[model samples]
Target chain A: MNNARRNRSFLTDEDGSAATTAGFVIAGGLTFILLAVVLFTDVPIIGPNEGEMAPNLEGQIHTLGAESWTNFELYDEVDGTWDAESNPEAKWFLIQFMDTDCPHCWNEAGPMSDIESNFGDRLTMISVAVSLNIPSHDSDREEVVAFQEKASLMGCNSGNSDCSTRSGEPHDWAYFDDLDVTIMDTWGVQGTPFIVIIKPDGEVAWNQGQNQGQEIMEALVEMLPVVEAA
Target chain B: MILSTTVVLVISGLTILFGALSRTEALRPLFSTLGLGSLVDEPISRRMIAGALGGILGGILSAVWVWVIQRQEIIGSTSLCIPGSGCVAALSQGSSNNLPFTGLEFGLFFILLFSILGWIALTLHLDPKASNALRLLSWGRILSGAGTAVAVWMTIIHLAFVDDSPAICPVCLVLLVANIVTFAQFHLLYTSHSNGSWNDK
Candidate 1:
């Protein structure tokens, strides 16, 4: 009976009730604040945000000078070792950092091909295939090689991996395999389909990001005379 | 996914409402299964109700937040973290990551809706003459409780095993902890009641 009486008293305790209510109020308020923050803001408090500088890979990857195009060497399924700087046939280098798996990169290929044909001997476009699948979303070398062949980006034979030399009509452009992303990281390319036009002098003339395929070629067209004048 | 989420939310919301009412006879078995087998004699049904509602609130908030993050991610935006908070990296690559758990959000929204209904039902239960109508409300607790349990489990797994980075949303986790505490309080109330240490009369 005594225990029953005490239990009854506890049940009606306004102090306990008030404390519980207070706790709920505090929790609800905090949850509201969190919801607002997450919903309204961009850039998580923990992750990388936009507006960071694009990496400049001048000396580390390829020196920025006349030798920039001919000296830059990347592996090709056909050519084994393709040299960009030694290609005396081209006057400028239009280097792009792309991933085979990236949809945007695939979409950008048409405009890039147009730029290649239109520029003729004025430019040597090099498509640097960087595989992003390392550590997390890892892509293999085969995938990259296959991407190059299907897209017909130039200088790679997808059907015959062991076959050397440009089997078909050698694409006017060049391709480089950066499966390790050594060049990408050095250039701070966190996204795919990044385009940068380098003059024969090795100076960065223009670079476009995201859905800038048209702008990229246009920029190349605009920079043609600037390169010739130098 | 949306349909399943809705079903879970509606059921959980009903269960939470039922748990809030004073019909211990219907809820006795449930309490026992929830590890609260002590409500036969003494009763702390009010505390249990409070705990259950609290858990629902937290769970709903978490579900909503995750849904929002997914939307931002799709738009090529990052979910903002508190400055210098050192949260883990974004869940995945921005362009490629298709956000998961949209259904969870839908469920949480309905749970919130049901909770409001439950609160109204509780008011009616407090009236002496309206007790019978409120009995139906108690049945909803099973759904609510089960849904809360699932939400809690999913959140824990994401935090524990899925997240490889150190960054975590403290606010989301804190609310989840609050929900867990609510669960504990519910167990405590029922256990105490059965053990003859608590009374709701």
Candidate 2:
């Protein structure tokens, strides 16, 4: 049988012993060299390449038009729809692309809430928090929720006393969980706290840089009628 | 998840080690059922095989722990819902985002490198056609020993020094046993060979 022959040959293979002894010496030598290298040097084994640049679209102008807003499927905060339709009562939209940990995003919350309250029914304000990979901060969903809670952006404390005691107009807050920033890319948002005002007809009216919350609202008032007419 | 996986791998390593040391023909059947019979063919080969398996699993599990702790950096977004909104948004520069070389990632790479070396050693042991089987076995022993040292060092640094845990991890303790047995088996083999007792077998 093949098994018997294999067993007999395995026991009688005298050449293997000498070769194994040689292999031992070579293996010992190689291991010694490897250990020395490990002990002496600092090696980078996993992770991103060095000198990578952070994506910053600060001060860049976007030539976006009304036709551009047709297929944006922002993950819904309520219905969980990928392309959740906006409320019919709302005529205009103020979309703010922001990083949850950005100090400027935190600072702009008050001004945005003011605009939401003043424009009531005339305009819908949505804050889209983007996750940023900074050295100290990990801007993710938990951090997004925490930031929303800290700033009361979820309108939890808004006029409605249905859920609990809270204040402020319940602003729409949503984000994309698909890991694709096609919406952000389409808008040419390079920096945090980027604001874009869209007319009811899906035409972009305002694309402003960071830290212009007050100016944005003032500009919105001027453009509201024009957006409504469209 | 990482913690649970580490526990399972550690338990598997222990079973292999215990079976090898006992060398009961009864244990051979059990080991064969698990696809590890040839591994315990002789006193020398058994320890090397166990050490290699332990190192491979330990290296992978520890690396997983590193990834788990830094999920935010790796995946951009988590399922944790915001209190007021139904929206979850994650913005990153690109896929290149978690690629920055960090200590944890680097440690994982090192563990994996040594684990590969341990596998190479295992391969040499099983290769009947290999003329340098004895020499390769020595190398395999060294590789396993080195891998075990790095694994233990990393575990100590991560759990004790870096994370500042009060006790050593049970998984890490199991790896430590595997490491100790590897060296013990190597010593026994060397002594037996030197005394010409190995030839009697």
Q: What is the clash count for each candidate, in the order shown?
A: 33, 23
**Whose DockQ is greatest here?**
2
Residues A195-214, candidate 2: write the lDDT tens digits.
77655433355667533454
Residue B174 local lDDT, model 2: 49
Candidate 1 lDDT over B2-40, as tens digits, reads 343335344544443544442446655665565545544
Task: Report the lDDT tens digits of candidate 1 across residue range A1-230.
Answer: 99998877765454345434544654575567556745664532221112232222321132212123332332111121223445433466677887655656655655665776678667766777777763333444444444444433332222232222222322345556576887777666678778776555344556565335557666765656533232
Give model 2's clash tally.
23
Binned by DockQ into CAPRI classes (incorrect, acceptable, medium, high), candidate 2 is: incorrect
Give candidate 2 regions above 4 Å deviation: A1-230, B1-29, B32-107, B128-131, B160-201
Q: What 10-residue stretch in candidate 2 chain B is worst by lDDT?
A: B85-94
Query: Each candidate: what lDDT?
Result: 0.46, 0.45
Residue A43 local lDDT, model 2: 25
Q: Candidate 1 at A170: error in angstroms?
A: 14
In angstroms, the error of model 2 at B151 is 2.8
